[model samples]
Target: MAQPIIEFKNFGFQYDAQAEPTLYNIDLAIQPGERVLIAGPSGSGKSTIASCINGLIPFSYPGRCTGSLTVDGVDAPNASIFELSKHVGTVLQDPDGQFIGLTVGEDIAFALENQCVAQPEMKQTVERVARLVDVENLLEQEPHALSGGQKQRVSLAGVMVDDVKVLLFDEPLANLDPAAGKQTIELIDQVQQKTGATVIIIEHRLEDVLWRSVDRIVLMGEGRILADTTPEALLAGNQLAENGIREPLYITALKYAGVSLEAEKKPAHVDTLRLTEQDKAAVRTWYQQTVARPQAPAAAPLLEVKDLCFGYSEGVTNLRDVSFTLNEGDMVSIVGRNGAGKSTLAKLICGFETPRSGSVWLNGRNLEGDTIKERAAHIGYVMQNPNQMISQSLIFDEVALGLRTAKLPEDEVERRVNEALTICGLYPFRKWPVSALSFGQKKRVTIASVLVMQPKVLILDEPTAGQDFRHYTEIMEFLRSLNQKGYTVIMVTHDMHLMLEYTSRALVFNQSRMIGDLTPAELLCDSTLVEQAALKETSLFTLAQKCGIQPPEAFVQHFIDYDREVRDKWQTV
Candidate 1:
């Protein structure tokens, strides 16, 4: 092993306002130019670990620390955040806070300017990093308008402009669509290969980020570093489920086929499937006999859309004769390519956007002319970006806003707010300033605020966009509870995994038309429909094709069973 650029020696920390330490007896080391991913379920302190590297934990966070954490050969116990900033460039999960410049170029040069770099040289350096991140054309655009993926890259460019030795990313894939998430991971790989900067990524989307480029995976659980192993070894291990995180879809599929790691005789994914036609036939036979397909739910329609032709501006059709029904107690997800009317339908249902020549019915009542306030009684809508919905500074106050509007008693407001905070895993920071919380935490707060309202129908627009695995599961489990209790839950998302697990129905949108309202299995099986809707098949679904078998219904059923089990386990006691 080479000399470690970073080291943690018996490190332990507790936020000044926290009752218990977030990280306990942490001991780790990172060699120079090594790319490491620190991952775990929600509340495992992955983001806190990033703070220690960037000198935010012991200083900005006002926390108590024992022992030492050193980065770039300097002990964190004594170094100031400004000092740490020179060596460790950080791109926070939320790009909104990270962007200081009114323009893309100016935002990238903010840190450089503070360092007293010459103006002429700053221009050259900013342009270089922006182009490297493929945001050159967006240099003059406002950061607010860029999509999730572009904003994340801009944040990375801003960090790289200072030429730091180590780069830290906290949940870089949280908000991006799957395609964008994959691209960001690829970009990180290309950048590391080119610069060899010691990169440490803290994220929950391990299935996408666990590429061959990363050297090791650091798994955190219950305030402890449980396992620091190669991604392959960790996936093959038994502890992933105990930590409340979803295993990769490929591993889960193999397990469903009654194949165990021990029986595979140390085989990698490539070696498991022989290319011989006979061997492929045997695998297909096993799946066909073993897997059972789950039947789609049997129920009456809960919400129906009829001839929903809608558009905001002239000549641009957002929704054209869109018609679909959401069954009672159903968890249906809408998946399509960008600008594919997924959000437009959600807005129409929530009464934010009215249809030009159609009607939206909720439980047999037409939504037309119903004030957003009237619709609010049944549907709780959370937008794509949490920033747009967030208005309060304190966490509890934000969660209680709707309850207060109803003129609930003070004690009743506290009760609902506290319950919501706990369900969303934000109770510990209930009184903290929303600005002080990290982006992932803020996303959780937004959900908690809505759940507190207890609406009969909850429509979440890209709720898991910038979430880590823990946060992702927390939300899915929460929604499952709502669905089980007979709330018709609908999510507008580009995440296929969310649909596969929680959704009872799948809606495909493309070219401003409601293409097909089908099951996840059906949607994946019809590759043409998926392509038309600008969606991709699950890796497992695609792998099944290579194995010479159609996707088995049993695999999809098993996924729902597993999701239900997780939901049952995580509910508030």
Candidate 2:
């Protein structure tokens, strides 16, 4: 029998200088060339399992490891991080912190340099890995200057150059736009096919990547792997959601159609579930009705944009000749390719940046005159990186910071802070030190911090970037509840999944212009517009096509309405 490339036999681990083990008895194995998607909810010990493959647990993290965890032929606990590098290559969640070079080319070469590769051979290796990760065109660019997706691709190239037998990707698509994220997944599939390396991926959005290719899916929660099965079988069960794993929208749709485990034998996964004439007809009829009629465009602008334009530098024009209006209760998504000034536009409308020209009127008040603090009375902006928004050492204090900063009464602060914590799903951990939390938990603290302020409009930048399915739903469900209470939300995101599932309207940005503003179904149907804006048509739509459904409008709209309120924010541009 062929030796397994990665094996975790009844393994458990605890960080050094810590009280309890973070992981307990994780049993997993992967043969050479197998692709496994390791996924679970926030704080599920998913990261801990991936760390063992790279020897990060016992080396950099300093932990007590039990049983056996091996990569290639060596035991992980017995090897230093450097020694394990010979057999394993790791790509971390945050691409910014892993850079070792000023330029993309240099970054990929750094690992090769450390290996003492010949100068001529190193040049060839850099070229080889660049193509492997699809960053060949970015070789001469500065690492810091690249977009979030580009930065991740460069990081992948750095690891691939080493030709390590085992490859581990930790949330590789977290910060990527839909288009880039799909391309990256395709690259992983290509790399595996060509090199036959053992690939293990940890991600929140499984359907977007690793779809039919993943050999197995491991679900974890509260420091243990609760279930291990093929992707299709795992998604077919609602039990995963109970276990803190969020099932994909398409799977949930299957459940709703009476094809669920409760009604019929769950066919392992949606891929193997098999579509029937009735299944196709039921799904098809819904699609035809939705596509035939999408609630007639809403009128009477809620927020008007009169030739609104913004820029950050002398020669660059971020938003040019942008004119549009959003009505009350409109859940709008502002989307664009990387560096198309999507974030810049969010800053302008929210008063973080003063527009160079034109006006963004919110309730008849031009946004330019208001300070971000004054705008906070109506608009709350959640920064993309939660680390930047976090200030207090403890979770409770962090959420209370806005209220405290306003010098609110003790009674008012306590009442409001607790409410926000509960809404953001951080109520139980309110007293926990902020440092003890995972990345997703840190993000929740930031959301709770902003929500306590009670703004009329909320702007979330990449809210679900690092979250798994379960937490993604928790946050969005809260936002939907808030929207029901009359909070207008405008999100700036690269996640088309979030856009489809939550927003009422889309503000498509391309070439530094507000190309078009349309409904989610309209946006997905326009292949040219989606591509121009650097987004891929969602996988649900693609899968529906495979099943021969016309347009898949119902499935597309299912996600759009999942987190919305019925009160129409009916403004279209």
Candidate 3:
């Protein structure tokens, strides 16, 4: 039998500044050439474990490490990062952060250059790895100028150029669109197979990572490994939700309808999860019992755009003659591929960028000359990166900064800030330092800051990107409540679930053009539109097809409506 490539025995890790250990008593082993997924909610120590494997802990993070961790027969804690790099290669969440070279080819050849490989050999190796990762055409391009997916491919090439024995991916799919994310997972699978490397992926999107089969899934929570098992067994029960991890939505739907996976034949993959005739009957019955609440008729338009055209330069157009109308109380999602101009549209609307041609009108007034600050009164734009929006050191101070800036009375500021914090589920952590909060929590703080202002239009870009199921639901539910209370919400997101479960309408963009403005159901059901927009068919839709349901579109719609109804009732309770 082959020796394990990675092993951990009673591992515990604590930062120098932290009073309590972040990871507690983790015991795990990965055999050679095995692919493993480590998944949990934000702040659950998934990344810490990855850091340990890549020799980032104790060495780079100033953390206290205990117990034993070995990577390819080397003690990880005592080994230098350089020593570990020869055996284990790490791909970070942000592709841009990993790039140290000016161009893709240079980046791929970096490790070889450090190893003092012959010039000819280094060039050959860079070309070979670039071709393997399908980034050969991007070799001459600036690493930072490529799309998110392309940058990821470049990062993969750079790491794999070394032919390391173990490859680690940290939140690989976090910043990608649905199609790109799926492709990235496929690429990872290909690399693992080709190199016969032990692969470990730390991600929050388990279902997405499950696009390709993995050897095992290690679910973590509150700094401990709760379950390490086959994907079939791990998802067969409520273990995921119990540990604050999100199981696939289709599984959640089946569970809600009282279908039992225990009695059914266990399928290896979620896509292959088959429902019995009786189980189908139960789901149909649940659908019949649930009633979807009708949305209120939209009021007069609050925001209108006409012939909007903008670009960073004359030849490059981000938005081309885009026109859309957002009515009062509308909850709309702007979705498409990575470079589909979703954020560009948001910036144009929020007055961060002036349109080269055409006009934007708010409440019948032209916003062409409005400054970003002037527009902030009516439109609140929360960037995808919370770091850009966060400025205050304390959570309470951050949320209340907007109110205080307006010179609101002390009592008014206190009441509104606390109210926003409570809505965002951050009141409990209101006193905590902003620096100590996780990425998801900081996202909530930024949202709370915006919520206190009570802007007529709230535009959030990828609001739940790095968040867990619990926080994602909380933030979406809060946004839904605000929409009901007459705030127009526009979300720029790649999460198909978010669009289907919450938004009433979707504005689909492709190649800087708004191709379709339709209901989520309409957009998802049309395969042509989904393909053109670089969106994936929802797993619910795929499930219906796999189950041999006739009129699969109708089944998808029914499931979506049923889910919305259940969510509404649950929120109320």
Candidate 4:
């Protein structure tokens, strides 16, 4: 049994500032050389548990503890953070926050230097780990200048050089593109196998995490362990749906077709799932019987970008000859790999950045003369992080901040704020403190603040980056409702599922060029374009092929239509 490298016996913790304990009676154990995944919705105490294991609760957070906890044979409550650092290494969600050294090689060697290892020995170890994580070529590059995926690899190498017994990864895929995310999972698997270290991953993207095989899954919600079991057993039950976690896409498709799932069949991984003739027949029949709804007619062009080209520096172009027309009442997704000019396009449209050789037109009016504030009336851009957008402490004040700045009458400000709050489903909490809301709720508050500006177009950057399936659905559906209300919606995102399910159109970018502008199904069906844009094909496409469904794109479109219909009915109920 390897003495269970990490154990929590009815352990609980509450920060001094918090009245109630974040974790409640958490009983968990992780054996040596094991790969375990911990997943839950927002406020589920998964982060609190990770803090306890990493020696941040008592040492850094100043919290009261109950019961007992141990990590790598050390009493976590009694051990100093410096002591625990020897046995457990943590990779944070944002890799940028953890980099201390300027260069990649320097960052990886920082830990060894602190221990005062011989220069020759430290160099050998750093090079070995850099090669192990495939960051050897990036040794001389600046850490912050690297891409999201590269930064993650450097963070991993920085920790691995310590020779720690356990590795803790907190939301490692939160900011990566699709291809980068897959590579990250593969890299993590390689590191675990080569090092024989105990691995614990805390992430909300269960489906993506299942890209690699895991020994067990720990599901948590409301400060308690809801289920601690193998991936197959957990997927075979209703716990994931009950706790707001998303299962693998193929499993959900099989369930939609009324195919029964059994743990023995290994429904966790798509490649190894044992499907029978009955299952194939069920999926084929369901696909054949389902008919896709007709797409709506395209509306008039509301915003137009004419041959836009912009560069921050002399020779480094951010956007090159980018042109697109956003029609009224349209919901479009702008997607690509990291640093693919998606955010830059939004900035140009919002007048934050001037295009070197282009023009922007809104309803046949040139916006070149408009200032950043003047453009706000026609276009609203909501940043990815709600904290960056929110300024006021109360919900009402936050939503009304923009309207009040314009010196609107008191009655008009109240009416506009109330209207926006109601649309965002936050009217009931209008007077509540902003800090009291959940992450998703705060995101909605940010959107409400934008909606009050009465903009014709709403641009959101990664609207559901860190959200679970339940919150993702809520936020996307709310945006869909707004799109239905004749507001043009543009989303700059990396979520392929959101693009395929919630959006009708997709604008694909590659190397700072608009490579493909097509339907989401069309884009996913073209493997060459998907690869070029650094996007992964949906599992539904593979499932369609396995079931002998003709023209996999049609099957995907049918699934999208059927899923939306089901959600629409559920919402009505």
Of the candidates shown, which would achieve the greatest lDDT relative to the real structure? Answer: 4
Evaluation by lDDT, superior candidate among 2 and 3? 3
Model 2 RMSD, rounded to 1 decimal: 5.0
For candidate 4, lDDT tens digit of each residue in 1-573? 469999999998888989898999989989999999999988899888988888898878998999999898999999998889999999998999999998999999999999999999999999999999999999999999998889999999999887999999999998988888888899899999899999999998888888999999999999999999999999998899888888777888898899999998888887788889999999998888755586688689999998999999998998999888888998999999899999999999999999999899999999999999999988999999999988899999999999999999999999999999999999999999999998889999999999999999999999999888888988998999999888999999999999998888999998899999999988988899989988888888888888888899888888888888887888889
lDDT of 4 at 151: 96
Cα-based lDDT for every prediction:
0.78, 0.77, 0.87, 0.91
Please give the lDDT score at residue 320 for candidate 4: 92
Best by TM-score: 4
Q: Rank the candidates by lDDT, best first.
A: 4, 3, 1, 2
lDDT of 2 by residue, 1-573 (tens): 688888889989888876888899888788888888887777789888888788777777887888898788887889888889888988887888899898899999998888788999999999988887778898999999987678877887888887898889999888777877877787788888878888899988766765447888888887888888876666656657677555665665555445534324334444545666677666555444432235634544557778867777888887888888877777889987887778887777777787777887878777766777888867788887889988799999988888888899989999998998887778898899999987777877887888898876788898777876666766676776677666778888887767776777899988789898897777877889989988876556654775586656655675355323221332121
Higher-TM-score candidate of 1 and 3:
3
Question: Over 4 Å off in model 4, which ranges?
Answer: 292-294
* Predicted structure 3, TM vs. truth: 0.93
Per residue, candidate 3 scores C-alpha lDDT tens digits across 91-136 of 9989999998998999899988888999999999998998888989
Candidate 3 segments whose C-alpha is farther than 4 A from its true place: 262-270, 395-433, 436-438, 548-550, 571-573
Relative to the unseen true structure, what is the C-alpha lDDT of residue 227 in candidate 4, on a scale of 0 to 100? 92
lDDT of 4 at 2: 65
Q: What TM-score, to 2 decimals, does candidate 1 have?
A: 0.81
Q: What is candidate 4's CA lDDT for residue 382? A: 94
Better of 1 and 3 by lDDT: 3
lDDT of 1 at 290: 34
Q: Write the per-residue lDDT of candidate 1 for residues 4-80, one digit (tens) a residue.
A: 88999899989889899999999999998889989887778888888988998778788888988888888876899
